[model samples]
Target: MNATVVYELAGSYFGGTSSRPVPAKLVVADDRLRVIAGDDLLAGPLPLAEIVVSSRLGNTPRMLRFADGASFETAGNATVDRLLAGQGRRHGLVHRLESSLRYVLVGLLVTIAFVWGGVRYGIPALAEATAFALPEAASRQIGEGVLELLDDDLLFPSELTAEEQARLRQRFVPMIAASGLPIRLEFRKAARELGANAFALPSGTVVFTDQLVKLAEHDEELLGVLAHEIGHIDRRHGLRQVLQSSALGLLTMTVTGDVSSVSSLIAAIPAILTQLGYSRDFEYEADDFAAELMANHRIDAAQLGTMLMRLEDALRKCPEVERCADPERGWTTYLSTHPPTTERLQRLTKR
Candidate 1:
């Protein structure tokens, strides 16, 4: 026969059917546990395994829950710990972790690293994969109302003559054909609103502002810009950018528990598409694609660099007060959404 070890502690007992708690004493012997109120037996000598012990937190009362929906609440935390230890049971894992400074610092560092890595690499990779996997019809649908919205707010009908538009189209035909993407070229005049800009939509639509057309000194400059826009379309950079922003927004919502903010994010999609710039990686990828395409067509990629320089010089001449007042105009311009002109020019020159 094994020798029996016993322990006791005072607590409050709640029977399965009662709302009131009665003063009681808990008794434990070997593998069994029970509760006693004076001479009255509130609970029987049941297996200790059937009782669930709540972990310690601060000086909060601990709860020992019984199988029959009864419970004993006690503030004898140290005694409980000793009792659990005597029984060869593990307890207070959370409290143990919380009490350790090294563990807390390590945990915080791991969380920071996780969030940083997700934003830096994981999110962009996931967005790119999802963008590529999305159907063409879906991309087209996403872009359908965008131009109309831009026309309402920012753009105007092209003022170029019909013959001029025809000539540019004819000049761009060979490069467009070589791209193997369904391309739709649209013309708009931003006047002084958005100076020297071109942008590509997710739906294979590329918009060329009259400011950009007039700014170009050579046909090759225009073609270079065309190939760059086609690169955005071919690689689905616009859709990827939107996906990346949405993923980041969702991550923020999760961290902050602000579900209502999601509608505001959705409402801002048009602004994001028009005003926000693509990431550096996406810009470099598009530039490289443009460089290769221009090279294959025997066109000097340096013409694109030349046009970029002119656009920068033109924008620099804009009064700072006006530029600051209409920030979106600056954001949506060609140079605004691209990398530094000098670096891009260097890369293009090398090609």
Candidate 2:
């Protein structure tokens, strides 16, 4: 049943077909019906007419009265279904877009979880394994690097009088021995260059800056500082940090025999040092251990606290003395990397 379609909306009757009734829903979609007939599939030329028409089925019929007294009926149910299918397709597209966004959000959450878990647990285990597998040659290279860095500032050449030097040995040696670590202490007299910094090497070597000795108001201060550095060795903090930072480099070189990336990372060593503040918990643990060492040896923990207080005060007053020795801007290095002074003091005083 092929037919031409015509439209009549209001008082205008458009040329249309009677063979196929134009769908009411399509007509509603576009009301430009002066040319469209109810049966017009091909939107070709059709003469428009003036008419008032109405529908037959529903009470609200599409009514249009033609000038020539003719009329066209409204479209049937099948055309309404076609309009509904078009709407469904649009809704389906929106659903797919929403689904894609959900997947992206889920992927980001998974990535975050994996990274957080890896850092909290996997890194330490990986470092422990790497430490066992590390070769002597590699260890020596690391040791040499540490020694080179410390050599520039370690040892006080001429500042301590002979009696003062002997007294430093007596105070430090017994205290270190009391701490129960298999570590040795050596003093040097390069007083001019290495005044205020101390370090521990990977190969069990501890270097004390001559300036650090000079800054100490008493032996407890020096002992406190040295014990903290020894704690780093005992807990393997230094080894773990180094392994974690170099994990990618080590793994890449191990698998691919590439060294450039590792070398580049090594070259940025100073920047790494500047940023290597210990975790707060690690600092507190070290302080607690040092306090225990002092208590075990019958040395007063308050003396250590007093030493810190004096150092803090002296820093406030004669900043230039420490500043001239070390290039550090202030106590940011000690304060940020260590526990709060008040908290450490409280712990020392606790029964």
- Candidate achieving the largest lDDT: 1
Q: Kindly list the per-residue Cα lDDT of model 1 for residues 1-351, writing each as its tens digit.
A: 978877788989998999699999999987788899999899979988778899988789999998899999999998888887877888668888877899899989999889777777787788889988988887788888999988997899999999999999999999999999899999998856776899999889999999899989899999999999999889998888888888866776666564467776675454344334446667788889999999999998888888888787777777665553332255544435556677788888887
The collision pairs in model 1 are: none
* Whole-structure CA lDDT of model 1: 0.83
lDDT of 2 by residue, 1-351 (tens): 745343333222333444433433223323233325345532322222222233233323344434443344444423423433433422234334444868668867987687556654566577767765775344435655665554466443445577876887777888667656556555555443333555666555666655667777777778877776677656655665677667644543454463457775665443334334435555666667777777776777677677666555544554366433322345554545555566677877782
- Ten contiguous residues minimizing lDDT sum, candidate 2: 44-53
TM-score of each: 0.76, 0.52
Count of clashes, each model: 0, 34
